[model samples]
Target chain A: MHYTVKTAGDQSIIIYFGEQISKQTSQTVQKLSNIIESSGIIGVEEVILGYTTILIHYAPTRISFHTLINTIKAIIMDVDLAKTDERNTIEIPVLYGEELGPDLANVARLNNLSEQEVIKLHTEPDYTVYFLGFSPGFPFLGGLDERIATPRLENPRKKVQAGSVGIANHQTGIYPVTSPGGWQIIGHTPIPLFNPSDDNPFLLSPGDIITFKPITKIEYDEIINSQI
Target chain B: MIHIFNVIKPGLLTTVQDLGRKGYQKYGLSVSGAVDYYAHRIANILVGNQDNAATLEVTMIGPTLKVLETRKIAITGADLTPYVNNSPVPLWRSFTVSEGDILSFQGYRSGCRAYIAVAGGLDVEETLGSKSTDLISEIGGHHGRRLIKGDTITANAVHTNKICLSRRLSTELIPTYTKHVRVRIILGPQDDAFTAKGIETFLSSEYTVTKDSNRMGCRLEGPTIEHKNGADILSEGMFMGAIQVPQNGQPILFLSGRPSVGGYTKIGGVITVDLPKVAQLKPNDRVSIEKVTLDEAHELLYKQENIFKLLQASIGEGGGL
Candidate 1:
């Protein structure tokens, strides 16, 4: 398959390799990301990577839209997406169930599995970080066991507390901040996934593989109060 | 010295805002800032402040502020019947307010959101290179929350006895609120999803901004746009003025604080210059949509840039309120 680029807004361009989400599509998207970042294209402020698309934001005053698109297209065509190098595996600790996880029972009941079985299934597989979006430091993690797949709450909670781990469809993520959310909360992570005070705020980045390690509430609090 | 005051009565949702927070969106962070970015930029320029300077973004209902100190200030965006010390303050005109003067804003007579820019700008902790408040993440601005009663905002260190530009812009240059509004738009990546008739209806139909509108998006109540194929597409990147049609068929125009992306089908996007028209649209305000080519959009932005150049040349560059 080939890639296509389209104008998003006055100052942004959306580049896509495929229409659907797949491993190959993600690879293509990552390849595009690598090319843009390493291409040293001036005026390109940031390139947002997604499931199958990459949003390139540029400073309109500094660079024209045509020049940016052409520069990026040239870089994309020259880069080989098959070269996946330096993928990091990260282990994230989660305090599942009890007061930390308000919807753990609900998710397990919907999947016809006990709470313990749900935990075992959730932590058993290593998930890939598709991309970061929705809120600051919120990761769209893939590779969840389909049996534990659950739909978001019909009526979204007015507020989903920060660090609340949740599952939706085949993807699972953690809420970095309190906002109105519909995701089914299954657990909570005590670690500060996003802190503005720190130089490198986000704990995970795209192309990084993540595995969940079950921890107790005491461990959660200890980690939260302490440094990462 | 610059002064920052508190909200004696926060009319609706008033918060600190700047240009935006970029680079952080990839980490799922929202680019939350002024709902009307054009207005935010113009206000910053009018006050001789940096484009990313933090200012007070007042929603539909304006707030009552207690002036903490004497400072130069300018109010732009919406006409909210603003008064300081029981006297009407000129809109788009830089002026000084003495300490202990009560700056109160009543109901908005015109637009949905208004911006108040101080001469030296508001002093706030910057996060990720911006002071923009992302309410969803609770990370920026004055503790990442709406301005409440008795909140003391610190101002930057710079004081001037007189503003750089003492002249006020002509009424012809300033936008006026009316019942009829026409916004220019560019057709979208998802225009194929809607039937031709659906597109026509969207263009011709008269839509009214709902009362439920906010900084996130302006919900338009109008003719239901039906799609030819009922397919659920994955969420994608969305920007300010992007008109998204959900399953319910109602059109929602994304604003400044909208999510970085969405999954809904977007039929078109409002032109960058015309977004101020969308910004000024209030509840019950009827708006008409007009389609324009990409070339036209570029020309419009260019024209706006020329106007800024002219304004700066005529108005002096010393300092602005």
Candidate 2:
């Protein structure tokens, strides 16, 4: 689960492992990232955690490349990444069907189930936040039942509005910001996952758990109007 | 006092930009900033400003700005036939712009973008340590979007050192956007995955920058470089200059605000030194690729650092405006 720091440039160092994305790899990345951030290394500006790698950006004028490599290596060697635990569960109220969940019928048909069954299955269990990426605050949540596994749309829509709930591959996530996405849109959340104007911009972070609670469209409207 | 410009005519894609908001890439936010950093830096330096100071990033067609106060200003990159109060203003040099002076620029005579920087720099709140606009995130810069007509921008009068117009740029540094460019590239970590012919095709191909090119990526049209292992490689971290070959085999030269990572397999990455050439490329502009060793890439980067060091030594400490 450990690797050497690869040289990205005069200002960046990337720690790489296997090139695949998985929960175990992501947890290791999240653990390492937390250690680096809390350790308070000088000249280190930011640590960008990915599926299987971490990009550490530093101010070259303050810390030389050699010093940075040594500092990262020293920190990595002593840190025991296995002991990290305790996941926090976060409840998300999702308004499914009709105007909000436009694809609810499509998803139910794809899974060969009734619309009510689809909602029951979706809201049944908690999902782990494997990683956080894709348009600020968008979390790649794992632990979706294989029965509901769906592929992305063949031709992605030009634009998917923010707060749209989606499922692609074995994962489900809400689009934090309005951008083009290929995931199968199942529902929408009234909660703002990312708000730059707010003190806390992102709603979800890595290692946090999430569970959907079906809500009425009237409730969705209420939450949206009052969020500002 | 730095003269504020009331934009009378807004161009296609005029926005406030700086070096960009770094360290936000982890959240999948693109490092949105000036599409042409070299020109932006030059304009800042000419105006006695910091490298990351906010300035107007003007696209092909430039805007007509009315000076609201007296200030020092300079424009670089594209030749737009700029004028101040109906009198022609020289490019790549600073000039004192008086209050009520009407400053304007026309369509591009050469290059695709231009940088207009003021003495003290644009006064804007820094989000995540930068004034650069991220239109997608809608976070930084002037309300995080393109500049519009009738919009007045505040300027910070922070210039301590002034640059004399007599300090003209030498021929070596004066950018010539007219010349056909050969962008140097470093081989990728997955370079061996591609066949030798595939690699050769990428390096030798003379590609034309498609009109659809933007700050995101420059879609090159010419040779379709087919990959040996196909485009099924895992989505990995991407840099500013990474040349990714899509399913169709056309190489997309990613630029400033490309996604942090995607599923495409990158064949090679353009050297940082040659990025200025890539930045200046306009639609239909031809560009050739040349492969270089990692050492060569490091050497070019070192050379740039040395030049900055030399400038700092000559200008003295804390010389920025």
Candidate 3:
């Protein structure tokens, strides 16, 4: 559990667990995040977990940067990476092919597989939520089946609608909001990934497990219409 | 009762802002707030409002607001040359406007943005515990967007104290904006990713703020920082004042509206004390970064906070007007 801490400014410090992204690395990052969060250190505002880093934003007036660093260092020294917490598993219903996923055929063509095979491969493995980024509630997922791994579109779309599930290279994620992006679209999810009015705005968090369940177009319509 | 102001002209990018939403960045929510926090605080202080009271953050151009009710207000930050009923009003001071009085600006004068704080703050529905607008996500502020013509904004009911109306910030306390601004910064979470020469280029180079700059970030067109390895890193949480260098080598200085996380390598982050100066800078302004230790950054912040305390004390003594 080797790590390095660097000062972002007077009030924030970024703790890098490892250089690259891996489940093992992310687990350590999440554990440290959980510990620091529950520590109740005064002036500690928020602990934001990334793929392999934890950014701690604090109030310098309440706690000195040096003192906060010492407290974090002491906490990290005693942390056991093997300690795991119960995480929530979320099932997302996605509609594949045709208008729902305009680039599904292209993905199948690029991977030299039928549309059914691509869909089967995408759903087989349970992907891990690396972190939420790019847009609100948008998850950056890992553990995409390499067999269906395809490059992103050379030119990104001007606007990608919310609930559009996409893949870029070896990663797969759902677009929680409508934003201009470069990922290759594969399907559309009926569930709202983000709702500002809800008690919990995001459906997923770091260290959560996500499994995409394929559904027919009529089922997607039924889900969408039922929500309204 | 709704104390409202009708918008005659909404300026370029007028939006309601406060101290910003907190404890929600982990959900990928941005902590959108007033960019010029120093000015924002002063404006609120002048009108005897709480520090986090919502105010209108006016950009280069100023909005034309028609008073629907008599209200006490204060203007701070950029000198947009605001006038009430065709008569000019002073900056960094509190004043009262009567019913039917129209407030408008002449044009851009000094800084890039200004803060207009009413006595009770702009009464807008708070989203995620903040009145500040997240322009990217379109979630908060006045309908989660910028002010436009025909928009009517309400001010919360406040009992005005005549004594506070005489308040004015001392001349020395008001900040001045210039084309060439020197900002202090503390080097990196990923400074090692760059070569010594790259670090030198970043510190020594004079970067001009590009038009592409916005609340999200200030894109600088200057010397290309040579990366020791590739510029991309695994996406990590980003903070305000982060100097992120993309693959093209151009540096983008993240501000209040920056995303929760990013993948580009950041060389360093600007000290909190100097962010107001960065906020006041307009496009085409020349900015030079000065490297300072984290201790110095903390000391500077402490000094600024002390000055604020002094200002509050002086007002209590009835010295300022």
Candidate 4:
């Protein structure tokens, strides 16, 4: 449960759990983040949780850096790491191959498997959401089956469409918005991953479990049209 | 009550901004806000609006707007040589704009950005509790994008008698933007990952802001900072003013519209009080970093806050005459 606190800027401090990424370390990071966030620490504006760290942004006018550090340290000493919180398991419907997944054939060839087999392996295991980053509501997912793991495209596409499910090396994720990326695309989802107009903007959050459910292109079109 | 203005011409990049959206970075949401926060606050204060009231943030160029109704307004930050009805108006002061008066800006003058605050804040719908525009996500401010020609933006009706007229900030309080700027910083969440010589190079070298620089970050080209091992690190939460160095060793100073986290190594972070100076810098402007202690940075912020409070009190006593 040992951790180091470092100053991020005049108003923020980063609490580092460990140097490497591991589930145990991530759990510890999340546990401490929950305590600090729910503790009602005065002047704490936001508590952002990373894979192996947590950044706390505070208002200096209400609490000084020295006081904030001491308060956080005291909270850390009293936190119970064994406690686990209940989380949701979200199912994301995706359409694999064809125009939606432009890189699926390439990924299958690189992994020495058929496109169908690649989709099977990708959807088999439930992946853990490491954190949300790179783009809005984009989840950095872990637990990609090593059998279908492949490298990213050498030259990234100039613009990747929103809802693209992509894989790069051992990691896999979804592009929540239209952005430039280098991941190997295997499928596309019709469900809006992010909508700022909605009450809850993000579809998934850190600590949630995700499983990809293969759907037909007709179903994807139906979902898209129904939303309109 | 409706208060609107017709956009004659949209300058380079004009968008509505406030203090910024908070409590959403955990979901990977960016805290997009005013680039020059000091100037934003001062402009709002001069017009007798709340400090966090949304104001139009004008970039290198300024927009041309025709007042649809008579309203009190104030212009602050980089002097873009604003003109109202073909007559020059002063900077950092509050004045009334009559209906049908056309307000426009000349070419580049001194600074890189300016702020225009109405007596009542702009009445844009808030997204995630903020009116500031997140350019990348296209989700806040007016239609979640920059203002364009022919767009009309509405402002809340002013119902109070506290509207200020011809209220100007003192000459000493005004900031002068120069080609060469020195900003203070507090070294590292990753300073230990750099070689001592690399830190020295960063503190001593005069870096030129590249043309590609934007509200997200200030890209610098100068001496490369030597790393002890490599530049890549596990992606982690980032803050405003973070100086991140990538594989090329060039530093990119993250600003108001930066992403929530990054993988590059951060050598240091600039003091919050000095961010306005960085915001005023234009492309090709030379910048050097000066190291300071964390306590000193905190003290400087406190001092600035105190000055603002005193100024507000004085204005109340003088009745903004």
Instruction: Evaluate all candidate structures by whole-model CA lDDT and list the values in order.
Output: 0.80, 0.77, 0.89, 0.89
> What's the i-RMS for candidate 1 in angstroms?
1.6
Residue pairs with clashing backbones, model 3:
none
- By lDDT rank, best first, the candidates go 4, 3, 1, 2
Q: lDDT by residue for model 1 over B43-134, one digit each (tens)? A: 66666666668899998789999888777777888888999977888887767777889998855688777888886789998988889888
DockQ-based class of model 1: medium
Off by over 4 Å in 1: A38-40, A225-228, B159-165, B313-321
Q: Which residue pairs does candidate 2 place in steric collision? A: B3-B69
Candidate 3 ranges with C-alpha deviation above 4 Å: B162-164, B313-321
Instruction: Give lDDT tens digits, candidate 2, residues B1-321.
Output: 244888899888889999887766766677888888778887777776777889999888889898897777889888877888768888877678878888887446888888999877898888877898888888788888888887888899754455333233445677788747788887774565677888888888898888899888888988877678787655445677778887788888888867766667677788777777888888889999888875677677777767655543443233332
As a TM-score, model 3 comes out at 0.98
Q: Which 10-residue window in model 3 chain B sums to the lowest lDDT?
A: B312-321
Restricting to chain A, the TM-score for each candidate equals 0.93, 0.90, 0.97, 0.95
Return the top candidate by DockQ: 4
Those runs of model 4 whose alpha carbons end farther than 4 Å from true positions after fitting are B314-321
For each candidate, give the interface RMSD after superposing the true interface residues on Cα: 1.6, 2.7, 1.0, 0.8
Complex DockQ per candidate: 0.60, 0.41, 0.77, 0.79
Model 3 C-alpha lDDT per residue in residues A26-118, reported as the tens digit of each score: 888878888899999999999878988999999998998778989999999998777688888889999998786999999999999999999
- Candidate 1, residues A1-228, lDDT tens digits: the string is 587777665666777777878777777777678778776778788878877888887766667778887787678767776677688898889999987798999999999999999999999998888888888878888788999999988989998888899998787988887778999998888776788888998888888888999998778878877863
Per residue, candidate 3 scores C-alpha lDDT tens digits across B1-321 of 366589999999999999988878887889899998999999988877778999999999999999998877889999999999879999898888888999999978898999999888899998889999999888888899999999999988876554245578889889999999999999998899999999999999999999988998989999999899889898888888999999888899998998999889999999999999999988899999999998889898999998877766554344363
